[model samples]
Target: MAGFLVSCQSDARNATRIPPTPSEKLKSNWQKDAIDALTNNIRRKIDLDNSYFKRARIYFENEQYDLAINDINDAIENKDNVGDYYLLRGQVNRELNNLDAALQDAQRAEALQQVSPELYILMADILQEKKRFREAQNYLNRSLQMAPYDGSAYYVKGMLQSRIGDTTASLGSFKQAIDLNPRLLRAYQQNIIINNRLGNLNNALYYNNLALKRYPKDAILHFERGQFYNALNKSDSALLSYNKAAALDPKLTEAYFQSGSIYLKWKMHDAALKAFEKVKNNQAEYPQINYLIGVTLERMGYDDRASEFYKMELEKSPENQLAYAGVVRLQRREMGQYSTPSAREPAQPSAPTRILDTNRVQIRTIQPRRSIDMGTDTTRKVIIR
Candidate 1:
């Protein structure tokens, strides 16, 4: 809660895009159909424009924003008269963080007479990202008025409310989103975060459980459940949850980091080493991962390797006290001041959390550079550092 805020903006621009051949093999059935349609149309030289549009939508759904942009561009080039094509391109550009391009496309779409609630929502979300909050609010209000039961519009409203320091209203908006569309996973995630911000860990945990019931295979939710359990001092439960998350998505390096930290705490050095190694292998740049590895190595009496890791961490973060302490402890050990590193450990690192993006399921941890403004009153605007 201190570091991770669920922003109501897409991070799809930075997400990996699957290539066409791999996508055909690895993507969902709907994505496969779109690809097949595009492929067949290309081979037959028929209806290629609509085929590109359909494939672009599939790419968007897969979070392959770059490919989505390419396909949508091709579609627009083929048929610039269609309003929906401009709207789709605008959406793809928004996902790509091409805000200026997105705004231009939105304007084009509007001029083409595409005046739907979805288009309004897209324009509002784009404006929100641009920090034009008042304009965003106006567009969002219009979308809500046009489509009262649209869960996505409500979700965007929740994000706007949260941004402007109206947590109570934000929570209500998120709840309305959930009530309207139970499958809106991001709304559930936001509710869990707001509950945590309010110092209601139990409620946060309850929401996590609720989300898991709906999205049991969601690795990020499992990772969050682990964090909640660890906060509640349920270490055993935390480990189980973390392991489950890691199993679900081996790319989820934070799960390995958290599980390893717990293993280190339990003095299970070998297990700790393996978990940390998995994290190091998958994501060497993970926050303080080198420091954690150094501590685990020092605990296991591999002083030389431990010293190397400590130096590596210091290279990345010269101001890190824990890594600096690790180096000093090893130096002292070399001087025979201690037979082994002392029993007292450096202060454990704060638990790592994630920067949750809206409209996509990708999760990544941000360094604990600053704390959140967890004021008890919901009136305070939530600030992400």
Candidate 2:
């Protein structure tokens, strides 16, 4: 999705007239029947009041971004001058993947109420997505000035700072975010990555384990721990962690892929093929699994099987260069399998050492450009700049 955190601000003067705060508790337990009743009632005879704005949070809490947008649209139609309604609409539009509408709403909200802290954070997010880093920083600075202890603001700041190669600043911001809200998984992920990049392995492990203690069954966290251990050349530990991750969530293809790649690198071609086999029937379309299996088969001296695997990979991914290259190598192998180092080498052996790439088999893990905080639940959030 686009790079904006989706949170709303109250319109000017409407904050004082609030019912029970949605932040303190959801308006209801996300009851769809009540939502439909309110929606139908409003559509039948729209109330020209701020109640729609308050009800929009219920839709958001229910993960009904489209319904939320419709509610906010009605709220704006009734009171176009309200800045909070505009902010609400902006957030709703962002969730609906309508960036233009989101920006328009944000601009309108700013025009109505220029000093809203959440509005500044939202602007920072939009600017960051547009690659306007300097302007984004200015917005984050303004947001921080207004809400110094806001964890979301600090998380956005950390994400932006990391984008600009300010690792130290970004780390500081993530630390502050964690200090504000220890359960912020993304902030912990960023801390682990940045410290590992700086070769502070102990620090990385420390932070990741801290989060794991709190979120033991988080498959993503275990996968990330595997990444850290792999980075430090702890192959056995990494493989165990990856296996644990795969066992926790059977559809975690990256765990299998990485484990297979590790086995391939270690010359355990049988174990490697077994791991790659586990990756084949996963749900998230692990495109690299077939090619990796082909490589593993080739390494095991089964050229014909390897060729079949390579051909299958090509069928799955026509533009797979490594699969094509593997086919070429198989075609030209006049001598035996162990004739040369080049003959034994895979076209793209998953790092040939570590299994850390920006793209995982399904989702990008650990690297926190996207979800650096706010928890990876059903919240619509973003990393500004």
Candidate that would win on lDDT: 1
Screening candidate 1 with a backbone cut-off below 3 angstroms (N, C-alpha, C), the clashing residue pairs are 165-381
Please provide, for model 2 over 93-196, each residue's C-alpha lDDT reduced to its tens digit, 9 standing for 90 to 100.
76566778788889998998656887888788777767888998998999989899988688888989899899989999999999997776778888988998
Model 1 agreement with the true structure over 119-222: per-residue lDDT tens digits: 99989988887889899999999998999899989888999989989999999999999889887787899999999888899989988898898889989999
Clashes of each: 1, 4
CA lDDT, candidate 2, residue 347: 51
Query: In candidate 1, how many Å is residue 42 off?
Result: 2.8
Give me the candidate number with maximum TM-score: 1
